[model samples]
Target: MEKLQSPARDIHPDTRNGLHPVTLLNRNNLTLLDTGTSAEQFLQQKISNNIAQGHQDAFYVADLGDIKQKHWRFMKELPRVKPFYAVKCNSTNEVLQMLATLGTGFDCASMGEIDMVLRMGVPAADIVYANPCKQVSHIKYAAAHGVCKMTFDCEAELFKIAAFHPKAEMILRIATDDRDAWCALSSKYGALVEQCEDLLKTAKNLNIQVIGVSFHTGSGCKNTHSFCKAIEDARKVFEIGKKLGYQMRLLDIGGGFSGNSEFRPTFEEFADVIRQSLNQYFPNNKEVEIISEPGRYYVESAFTVALNIITKKEVYEKGADGNSRRKFSYILNDGVYGTFLDFYLVKEKQKLKPLLGKDFATEQELFPSNLWGPTCTNVDKLVNEFYLPELETGDWVIFPNMGAYSISMSTTFNGFPQPKVYFVLSKGDE
Candidate 1:
C-alpha cells in the first residue's frame, strides 16, 4: 500500500492536447522518454540504433505511457471494480511496477509470481492468489509470505487450505459458459454452479473463511453475455455463502477481458455490461469489494516485438492452371516457441499478420510466404498464409499488440533465447 501511494501517478497523461515531445532519447537500451518524445519516435530510433550497432536479437519495446493511459481509462470506466493486474499475462517488472504505482493490485497465479510482486514491495494485502489450482509448496509459500486472499474451486483445495493455511481468505471460482472464448478456461478450472453450495458448505464445516466468489469468462472472451452470466452465478453463490454463515466480502470477476488488437468487445463496452450486471445483482453491497483480474488489457497493446529475419528461401512451383506459384519462407530468430505462442495457440482462419519493419514501396510485388521459427523441427512453422515483399536475412519484422501471453509462455527448448525488452515512457512520463 505504501508503495502504491506514490505521487508520480498525479501527472495523468494528456487527454485533450497531444503528448509533449522529448529531446535526445537515443541511448541503446532501457531509456525513458522525456519532454517532446513519444513511443513511436523512441521505437524507430531504437530499431535504427540496434541495426546500426549490429544488435539483431529480437527485442520488446514497452510503452509505459500506454499502460498508464490504460490504468486511467480503467479507473474512469469501471470505478466500482478495482483491477488486480494478472501477473501471468506479462510478468515484466516495468509493467507490474507501472500498475502498482497507479494503485492497482496484483493477481499472482503462482509462488514465483507472488515472490516477484512481494519483492517489488507490494503488500500481500494487495495481492490475490488468483490461481485456483496450485501446488502445496506454492500454497505454503503464499501463506508464509502473508498473501491471504486466494481463490479455490474444489473441495480438496479447501481441505488443503484449512490444513496448510487456515487463515486464508478463500474465494470460490465458478465456471462460466465460455464457449465463444478463444481460450476457454472453464474446461480446466472453475467449479460448476451446482457445486458452489457444496464447496461453500465444505469450507464452513472446515472452519475455513470463504470471503467471496470468483469466475473467469475465459481469455479472448467473445461471448458478450458471459460476464453477466458469471456475475449472476456469483450472486447465487454469494447468497449460498451467506446462508452457510460465511461473511463473503469479495467478488472477483476474473480475467477474460480482451486487450489484443483483435476484434472483441471494447473495454468500455464490457465495462458497461459488467457495471449494469453488478448494479442489478450486488447493488448496495458496500461490504463486498468488487475486483477484476485484467492482465492483457493493460499490456497487450503496450508492447511491440521486433524480430530479425535469419534466413530466406524462395520456391517456385507450377499450379494446376500451369501458372507459376511463387512462395517464400523466412526463418526468424524467434517464433511460436518464443514470442508467437498466442498466435500459434489461437487457431484462426486469418491470424494477425506481422508488419515489415523496413519500409517497402506501396506497389512492391508481394509474394505469398510462410514464416518459420529458428528451430530444427518441422512443427516450428509460424505464419501459414502471409504475403510480404522480398526480405533478406537482416530484415526486421514487427509484431504489435504482442504484450499478452506472448513471451510469458516462451521457452528455450531449442536454445533460442527469448527477446530482450526495452521500456519507454512517452508524453513526459520520464
Candidate 2:
C-alpha cells in the first residue's frame, strides 16, 4: 500500500466550533475552505490534485468527523440502547480508536478482533463474543482474558462453553423474521422459538448460566416490523427464563441498522421503530439493560474511494433487432477483489461520480457504460449498464459510503494490492 502525502499549508475556518479553526489540506498541500468552496468541492479538488501528482490507483478517505456525527446521532436517537461496535465491519485501527475514545463497547466475532480491541486498552467486560459457534482455543482465550459474555443457540455450544469457560454469562440467540433482510442469518444462526425452552433447560442442567436473549433481524433489514416482532419473541423467551428460575438482565438486539442513505430506512426511522418496540416490550425496566451491535452505522458514510481508470474500450455488438449498438466498457485499478466486494456480495451498486476527465464539460454527452476492475477474471466487473459521462483512460471515479464492508472484505486476489488509506480529521484526535 502506498500513501499520498503533502506538506500541510492551509487554514480553514471551523464551522463546528467558533473558538477553534481547522486547517484543511488537499493532496497538493493546498488549503481548503479558505477559497469559499464547500467540503464536497474541496474533496473533488483533492482527488484531482492527487491524480495529477501520480498518486492515482485506488485510495480510501476516512473522515473522523463523519464517524463522530454518526455516534452523536445514534446516542441522540436511541439513547436507551448502548451500541457495541461490531468489529467484523471495517475494523480499521483508526475507526476502532475513535469508537474506543468515545467510550463505546465492542462486539467481537473472532480472537483477532477481541485481541485488537483489548490492545486498545478496552476492558474485557466491554467486549462480547457474539459469534454463536466458538472454537475451543478461542473459548480458552476469552476465558483467559476475562471476556466471558457470549451468546449460544444450541446445546453443543452450551457444552463447549461449560467445558472451556464455565462461568461465562450466556445469552440465548433466537431466530428472527429475517425474510425481509438483505443478508439473512436465521438459517445459519439463532435457535428456533420452539427450541428456546429446551435449550435453556439444557443450560440449567449443564450448570451454565443463561442470563438473556439476543437476535439479529439480519443485516441491512428494511422491515420495521421485524424488530417489533423480534422483541415480542424475546419477551416470550424472557418469560421462559423467569419460569426456569433464571434472572434475565440483558437484551442484545443484534445489528440490522442500514447506513446506505439511498436504501430504505434511515437511521432516525429505524431508531423510531426500535424505540417504540423497546418501550412496548421492555418498558422502564430498572433491572434490564438493552444493548445493540451496530457494524455499519458508524463507519459507512465516513469512507469514500477514489480509483484511477486504467483503460476504456468501445464496442459494437448486434442488438436483438439485428441492428448494431455501441457501448463502452471501463477498467479501473480496483475491483470486486479489492474494496468493492459489497458490489458482488450484497448487489450494492456504489455511487460512482466522475472526478477528473476531459469530457466532463457541462454539455458532455453520456453513454451506456460498464465498469470493471483491473483483474484477469471476468468477475472483476464493478458496475453493469449504468449511463456515465464518456471517460478517457486517465479519468477517475469516486465511490462514496464505502466504509462498511469494503476494507474488511478486500482480498489480495489476482495479485492486486489493497488501496492505501488516507485519514482526514475534522478536528484534533488523540
Candidate 3:
C-alpha cells in the first residue's frame, strides 16, 4: 500500500516573541481588526456581537474563546430597516441561534429551512417561504406547520400552493432585468410584469391570499440602480394588485447584498437607497410592512477563517512577453473543501491575510505566495496568485470578510472535515 500524506501541520518558521499571522494580518493594515489585538482577546471586547466563552474546538461554539456572537453589522445608518436573514447563507445551529436571538426574522427557501427555523423556536409567522418554485411536499409541510406566507411567480405555482395549502398567504416574485449585477436572479425565478394581472386573478380565484410583492435584483450587485429599478418594477405590481382590490401588505426586496470587503456597501447606504425608492413608490403607506432579505450584508464581515500554512515554494511563470516572472506559493491545510469552496471552484475573488504566531521572528521574511488546500488534486488551489509575507509550513493565515455565503456553501469534496467555528462575545455583556 502507498503511504498517504498526513494533513499539513502548522508551521512555526522561527523562534521569537512575535505575533501570529492571524493577528498581524488583521492589524491596522488589513482593517480586519481595529487594533493589534489577539484573535481571542478581540473576541471578548465587542458588545453587540459578543461570543460566549469556552468552546473553541467544538464543531459548533456560540462563543469561541473570545469571539462575539453579534459580530454581524446591521444597517446602522438606516436603523429602521429590519433584516430577514436568508437562511440559505449559513444554516448552522450556531449561526441560526445568534441571528434568531438578535430578533431577525428568517427568509427560508424551502420547507426544510422553514422547519429548521421553527425548530429554533421561531414562530411560523416570522418566516417567509421565499422560494418561488416549491415542491408539493414542501407546500404541504408549510401549510401543516402553519407557515402561511410564501412566494410564487407563476399561475402554476399559485395553483400548486392552493391545491396543497389553500389558505397559504403569498407574494408575487417579479423578475427584474439587472444585467449590471454580478449574479442576476432572472434565470431562476420571478414573473414578468406583463403576467402580473393574470397571476393575481389566479390567486384570487384559488383563494390564495396575495398580500405582498417581492423581487431579487441578484447577488453581488454593484450598481445601486439595480435596486432602484427593482423597486420601480415592484411598484407596477403593487398598482396591479390595487386595481384587483388586493391590498399588498409586504414588499420583500430579496437578498443580493454583497459583503466581499472589496465590494461591500454600507448597510446604511444600501438601506437609504432602498428606503428612498420605497417611499417614492409607496409614500405614507404605513399600513404596509417593508422587509428585506439580507444574507451577506449582516454576516460577511463578522468572522474570519483561521487556516494553517503548510508549505511554501517559489516559482516563475512566463509573462505576456515571454519573460519569467517569479511568484511564491503557500499551501494551507484548509481549502475549498472546508470554508472556501465557492472561491476555489468558482474562481471567486477572496481577501487573504497572514496569521503569525506569538513565537515567530522576522515579520519581513513573509513573502507573496499562492495558497492551496490539502487536497491531492491540482485544482485544490485556494488563491491562484496572492501576495503575502514570506511564510513557512505551520504558520497560520486569516481570511476575513468570510462570514456570509462561504460557510453555508462549504462541501466535503476532498473528504476533509470542516474547520471548527467559535463566536466571540462583547466585553461588558460577559
Candidate 4:
C-alpha cells in the first residue's frame, strides 16, 4: 500500500497543559470565563437569562473545557492508545470542530457521518470506518474519498471491500464475552475468536489486506477480565495473521468505557488493567499502533440540559387506607422522540434525575411525579414515579450527563424541534 498523505498538523498547544483552552463560538452565546468561574455558574447564568427572556423550550449548555479535561486525562492514562472520537455520539459542529482542532482521529460508521467529518477538512487518513458491516455505496464512497482504514468481520464484507476498496486497511473485529455489559453488542457484531483464523485466511485469499484486529467489550462493559481476555485473543489473531504474511499492526479496543466516569471497572481501575494487559500481550508496542473509539467518555458530563414544565396535571387516587394519594404528571417540551430516548428505546432506566433549576419553598410538599414528553406517543415518559416538589408550568428542571446519545439520537417525531445547544468554556473548571 502507498503511504497515506493526509495534511497532518501539530496537535493544538493547549493540549500540553491541564486546562485545554479554546475560544468557543456557537449559535448559543459562548461565555468565556476566568479561572475562578465554575460550570455551575455558567448554567445558573444561562438558565436565568433564558427564563428572563421567556424561553420555555428545552436547551443544552456544553462545557467545552470539560471535553479538554477528558482529552488530557485520556492521554495521561493509556498513553499508547489514540482516541478516534465516535462522531455518532455527539456530531454537533462545535464538538466535531473542537476535537478536530485538538488533533484526534475520527471513527465514522456511515456515509453521512463520513461526509460530516471530511467536510470539516479532516484528513481521510485520520478517519477509521469502524462499522464492520457497511453498505455497498458507502464502501464505494470511502474508496472514492481515499478512506482506506476500515473494519470487517464476515467473508462477504471482505469480498465487497476487495472488489470495491481493495486498498482498504481492514481490521478484523473479534467477538468477546460481553454478557455482563450494559448494552451487550457481541450478539450483533464481532466474529468469534475461533472464527478469526478463517476470516484472516479468507481475507488473504481475497487479496484483501488485513492490517490489524479490533474488539469491543460492549458499551459499559462490567468485567475487567473480559477486557484482558479480549486483548489476549487479539494477540492470538495477530500471530495467525503474521504467519499468513499479514502485518498485524493497529489494535482497536472499541468503546465500552462509561460516559459518567468509568463503566464497571472504574476509570483508574480499567486504565491500569488495559495498560498492564497491553504490556503483557503486545509488549513490542512500537510495532503496533493502538486506538479506541470512545463516544461518551468525551462528552457525557460536559453537557447540561434544562427543560421547562409546559403543562402539569395532578390526580388523586384512593389508597388502600382509603386516603387520597396524589400523583403528578407533568409534560415537558422534549421526551423520548426528542432527547430522553434511552428510557423509551433501550429501557436503560438511567440514574439521570432532574435537578431543580429554580428554588422551591422549603416547606413545599414533595410528591411522586411522572415526567412526560411533548410527543404524541404514549410511551414518551422520561421517568416513572420520580419525586419532586410541586412545580408550576415554566419551572426549570436541569439534567447533567445529557451529552451522549441524546442529541445524535433525537428525532422530530412529533415535529418538535431539538433543543438548542450552547457551547461554553470556563478557564478554571477542569
Give me the overall lDDT of model 2.
0.79
Where model 1 places Cα greater than 4 Å from the true spot, the runs are 1-36, 428-430
Better of 1 and 3 by TM-score: 1
Residue 37: error of model 1 in Å?
A: 2.7
TM-score of 1: 0.90
Per-residue lDDT of 1-430 in model 4, one digit per residue for the tens? 1111211111111212332233555533333433534456656666666676888878887877788888888888889999999998889888888788777899999999999888888899999999999999999999999999999889889989988998999999999999988778889899987898898888888888888999999777778888899999999999999999998899999886766862456766788899999999989868999999988889988888888899999999888999998888999988989788864665662555677776655556678888889988888888777777777898777777888889999999978999988666765434
CA displacement after TM-score superposition, residue 78 of candidate 2 (Å): 0.7
Which regions in candidate 3 have their CA more than 4 angstroms from the true location? 1-76, 260-264, 316-326, 345-368, 427-430
Which regions of candidate 2 are displaced past 4 Å? 1-42, 320-323, 348-359, 427-430
Model 1 over residues 255-349: C-alpha lDDT tens digits? 76766656567877888998899999989868789999998888988888888898989899888999998888999998888888877888462
Alpha carbon deviation, residue 117, candidate 1 (Å): 0.7
Q: Which model, 1 or 2, shows the larger TM-score?
A: 1
Tell me how candidate 3 scores on lDDT.
0.66
For candidate 1, the clash count comes to: 6
Clash list (residue pairs), candidate 1? 21-35, 21-36, 21-37, 22-35, 22-36, 22-37
Predictions ranked by TM-score, top down? Answer: 4, 1, 2, 3
Could you report the Cα RMSD, in angstroms, for every candidate shown?
A: 8.1, 7.0, 8.9, 9.4
Relative to the true structure, candidate 4 reaches a TM of: 0.90
What is the total number of backbone clashes in candidate 4? 0
Ranked by TM-score, the better of candidates 3 and 4 is 4
Report the C-alpha displacement of residue 21, candidate 4, in angstroms. 14
* TM, every model: 0.90, 0.88, 0.79, 0.90
